[model samples]
Target: MRYPLLMRFLFLTFLLLCASLHADESPDTIAPIRERAMEHQKAGRFAAAVDDFIKCIEEGSKTNRTGRRAEYFARIAYNQTRMGNFKDARENMEKAPRQNGWKDEDPFLMEMRAIVFLATDQIEPALQIAQKFKAVNPKKAEYFEMVAQFFGGDEKCLATPLGRFLFDPEQLLYNGAVARNPKDLIARRRRAAYFLERANQQRFPNSYPAKIPVDRGGWAHLFDPATAAGLPYSFYASAFYDLSRALEMCSSQDEPFLRVRRAGAAYGWNAVAPKNSLFISAATIAGDLKRAQKQGALDVRTQRALGDFFSETLPPVDQPNYRPRLRSGIQSYSRALYFTRDESSLRDPDWLETPETDSLQKVRAARSTLIGFHLSGKPVALPDLPPLTELAWKDYGNTLVAREELGSALEAYKKALEFDPEFVPALNNIGTVYSRLGAFDIALEWFDKAVKADPKFAIGWTNRAGVLDELGDVEKSLASYDTALGIEPQNAQTWVSRGILAMNSKSWASGQNAFAQAARLAPQNSRYAALSAFAKFANENAELPKIDLSIEDKTWLSNFFGSDSLAESYASKGAADKVFAAREWIK
Candidate 1:
């Protein structure tokens, strides 16, 4: 009995030794490490993933699994590229084995090589690789080709039929992907982004006669004909639809960004052209025109055109049809805020402690990750959500402002400040709300804080100038206007405001110059033209120039001249100095 038991024990020991030896050469031995590496990659810890992938390659090499080792090498190279180690990525990519004795035949290896080439700005090689894989993986290949074309930035190439088909909104490649798979969040997001970019291009066409630069403050009242063209409602509607679908398909980690984007699209859809109103219409303006004519106001063909313009441009006189859409946007931003705030605790500690100066850089980094995922079919990790939370609150505040809920808008903006006290937009908006409420001193204080936070903020300076003007600090207001103009000379609205202040102060020459500049910047706006003419007449005591003044402008002048007929008589006589005496009523 003792000899039989010893024999059983020895047999078990021999089997265990053999199994251990087999494990060393089995692919299953690397499974745990591979899983860990994939987890690291999915979490955006590319450096850690690179190390694990290197270990996988080492283990695969021991098993003489050349194909598996090649895959591991490709993975390592991809992770290295994500980590911005381009040289290392290229070196590792070169280690991946050629398939069937052809270097470009292996789809996975080619993909890794193309990505590395793209990272290194080798657009031509990337394009070649993309073309080579066109038949093997058309979806990925098309994406690579599109990115290569974008990086190449060759106008001649983009003007070609193939390039137009690739980049044009009507023929976008993502449209096909989404059509094939409605649940493809990446395709939906990309299509939505494409529509938005197209809408922006339409809103600010390159062929526009006057190119008014967009202001830093993003103030809504800037007068630019290009902006007046407005983004087509259909574009935003399409974008909103795709974004809504993406939201339905996206994971919880992606919900915040998608929600924010959807909210923005909703806002754009609600705010675009074809003004919604229950009261104001062409009929109302026509009736008003008849009354003016009965009162002997000089009614001309331009008056009808002005009425049409007003009918089209004016905000709804009552609650708009799009209020529910604005409310929906508000709800989306609220949900985004909730998700971001709840997930903040899970963010890297270093991100939470990032300095205010680095906030923009962090946002750019998050955007770059998104761009990479969009172009390369890479899985993006959850980006830092806190910086975006501030944007959520600011945009929420803006929607509330659009809804005319000033009190709620203040609360939303204050919430934004809670996330980032130095957030310039929130601070500027708070000041704007206060100015609208007639609390000039408090508004000035907030504007001061905004400009102090970022001296280069032109909008903050402009807001400060307006508040100063209201508070009778004319010199300081003018200086602030000068600073804002120095920052953004193409801001026509600022020029108009500065001109109005100049005229009120009886600085006639300066008023004329500012008004002329505004008119030069916004040539399509007849209101600016009229203002310039009036300023010129007032400054030089010259004959009144022929300018198309809107009905509202004529009414303003009528109020000043004591009657519509008297104002017309003064204009007919070029008695501009007499008209200039009514400058006190300018505002």
Candidate 2:
């Protein structure tokens, strides 16, 4: 579970060589101390290694050999970098000699300096040093360059303007690195991080457009490059793929970080395509976290990722075992908060220091989500969360609504409105809560405000239609449905709602067409198929199409119509009238 055997062997060999170099130049008293320091560094006891390394440096300074003393400085700096003491590492790295002549310790010295630069967000300097090894060691140079590029793409690596180039337009650098070495962990991780960041920046509904054209002949459209190019979720899918590859090559020390990234990408993909074969289930991600937990203690980032996965990515509240999942999520968030009690306590030695304030805000928000679910409209003391943006507050309100805490949800939505009066989602959700409370007139006003704020918001228009229907304004409701469908024609639920409205108004042909469109858009749903057939039967059509009934579909048909065979009977036009008379569609 440690680093690969060959890599460990090479690292130990390098350590031994460095220790043996100029052994007689330094006092024999320093040899055993330096060896112990190397052992401590390799064992991940960075604090102990730093202490031992300092002692060795103190002993080496008594000798007159400048090169050997400079090497000791570099050695201490490497340990300091591993301990997240980048400021001290940088100071020590500056004291190390940078002569043009190659020596046994030169490669280690250069690598330590580059690592210090990268740790301190100095990407350009890191790249410069990384390139120096190109002539002497091409593979090592490639590895360092890939590492430099990875840091260059980091959002926090702002010491140089080159950080803005997240990836090459075609990602040729990452691709070339992987091509040269298929097991290049840095290249794979960099690619994954790039896509994950891109996915984070994309807005919902716009990035996830409604009208994705489908070729009914087959699922070839799903695999089409053009189709993927238009969807933001494709970035998440790509990130998941790259992270999976990286995890295969990563050591156990690196596994938690990669697993957490992959889990995030998996959650995003599952949100968009839960029924796809490639969809990573919440259970699978939960298992991954469990395995990681069993490995040893987790860092703050890993714990936070685990908390988010449990709290937000689990199955819905109505599903079985949801209570257990919710409890687990709450515990995970609590643990995250426990670890993040202080900035210094959160040790993320693998990367630079993450903003402690930002970490706290996210952990607090996640805890609030679980707490809101637990309280469910009951008064309870909540965590003092940092101020959230309108979008964040609105999302929290949505989560409360999902938990069925209507009163608290309304309060949260109103809070979002205080931040941005014209926030459309908050307005629409407020309307939805009122509608659920049977306040149709108030819901209509809120819906109107939402659409007025953002006329392009199809969901707002759809809600307006539903409220109008509740108020018995049939003509206006139909008009609203038309407007909504025009904006987002591929929304199958909107079509279904519109079809129901048409059926109530006795517009048989319109209902039939709406239900048929819904069926075509979501062919996997047997309910849409049933609704379409019923609408056709109600229209007195001469030709009646049969409904495809799976075993579950047959059970549903039996429960709804008192006979499972009625769907099969509908295939023959002669029995269509009898099938229609079997159940009243006026519910």
Candidate 3:
């Protein structure tokens, strides 16, 4: 979670080592204080550490370590940099130890100074420092040249005039920094901050963009990189290259796909550019992300992120290739199901799923809408590519389920099983589809296979139990639920299911205990709360509490959703927010 720049990593690594580096003046007092401050900084609690470090610097005796004073100042500047205290970061960098021979030789000092100057209004100074450093250390010349070109101050850095006409210096600073460090994904994503800025700038050039917080390094402006404005076309092209390169370089740790949307690639120059090359480039990267998933190069979150990004960024609504784009997007979202992480604990709205939809079923619905539109005429044909991995086929099958193409969904699921015979999700889902078609006996066969394939999968066990319960095999269902519970004791939904099953069988004590566990595990779930309350009443021979809806809360919910019937239902459950949720509203 704490992925730092290489130098920042060094700064943190040294914090504890140099904790007691102060020369003897209350070294005992200073060491612990310094250690805690450094710990706070590592945890991203900058304000908490600032006061302690300041106290250490003021009260502790100066140590005789080489460049100790300079290092101390640099540490302060590093913290200041994170907090957007550019003024103090710059001051500290200036006070840092300089070499007797030449200051440019100090890479850390030069890098920090350039960073500070770039952030502030001193573009020229930053560019000059970068140029000197590039000369001092030619190996990092790319970074130096990028900074100089970013400010549009020195022609020597650029083979030709880059921004020959004009643009704000601040824009150049971020852009140049990214160009200088093309492989650094964080630097590359800084461009996303300019989304709104580029948008409004289209109609109002040479004017102000939105007022966004620069402290977070985002720009709320009205300038698009695609438009031939003060900056040349090459500038936008370079940015496109940077993003593509970053995507290629990205690993499982990043939500790089979603970052495309956050970066506003769709609305940035890529969306607005006269040439379709940028969009094409992005689409290519989208493919690369998929290939990465196939090769197991990406993490589950990245796949999910890409799936979300792919759906959201699909070549607008009117492109000729929209159908292929839709399928691709759906397939991407399906990747979320491939991971085995117990995501029931994830409470993010973006990750919400259903029995059929899982995380990406919503994207499948969008695909269906497009599919129906295509059926109005002869649909655009998609070029056939090589088959995807077993995981991708499973994803495609999920889309088929959403489209109500049940037979075709089965075929896709079968294909998934072909690639990886033991893939449990595909096996379980096949059983689910058969259950839908009233083939309970056949569905049970698939469920048996699923549990056999991956006995450890808690969901598979839970699904098998639910199916058995539906098919009038109560004894088998109860046993299956127990098996699932044994595997995943924290599964709140499983507890709730077991509670309901026990209640149906008149096992009052068992029902109450199960419901109580469910409520304890998921207190916010209205279903769990209602079931637990009911179970308690049944067990204790007590009356259920009457509903007490507040008039204010009811009215607010009614007005927000514009539907009294839905509001009343939610008001009963005390789940006002869920009243207008997509699944609920659709139902």
Give Cα-based local distance difference scores for all models: 0.59, 0.64, 0.55
Model 1: worst 10 consecutive residues (lDDT sum): 216-225
TM match of model 2 to true structure: 0.32
Q: Which sequence of candidate numbers ranks them by lDDT, best first?
A: 2, 1, 3
lDDT of 3 by residue, 215-271 (tens): 211211111223334332223333443444455566644544434433334334455
Residue range with the least summed lDDT across 10 consecutive positions in model 3 = 214-223
Clashes of 3: 9
TM-score, predicted candidate 3 vs. hidden true structure: 0.30
* Stretches of model 2 off by over 4 angstroms after superposition: 1-182, 203-223, 274-278, 281-283, 340-357, 379-587
Please, what is the TM-score per model? 0.30, 0.32, 0.30
Clashing pairs in 1: none
Candidate 1: deviation at residue 460, Å? 1.2
Residues 29-107, candidate 2: write the lDDT tens digits.
7779889987776654556777887787677556533335666777777766544355677788777765322353367
| Better model by TM-score: candidate 2 vs candidate 3 | 2
Rank by TM-score (best first): 2, 1, 3
lDDT of 1 at 191: 64
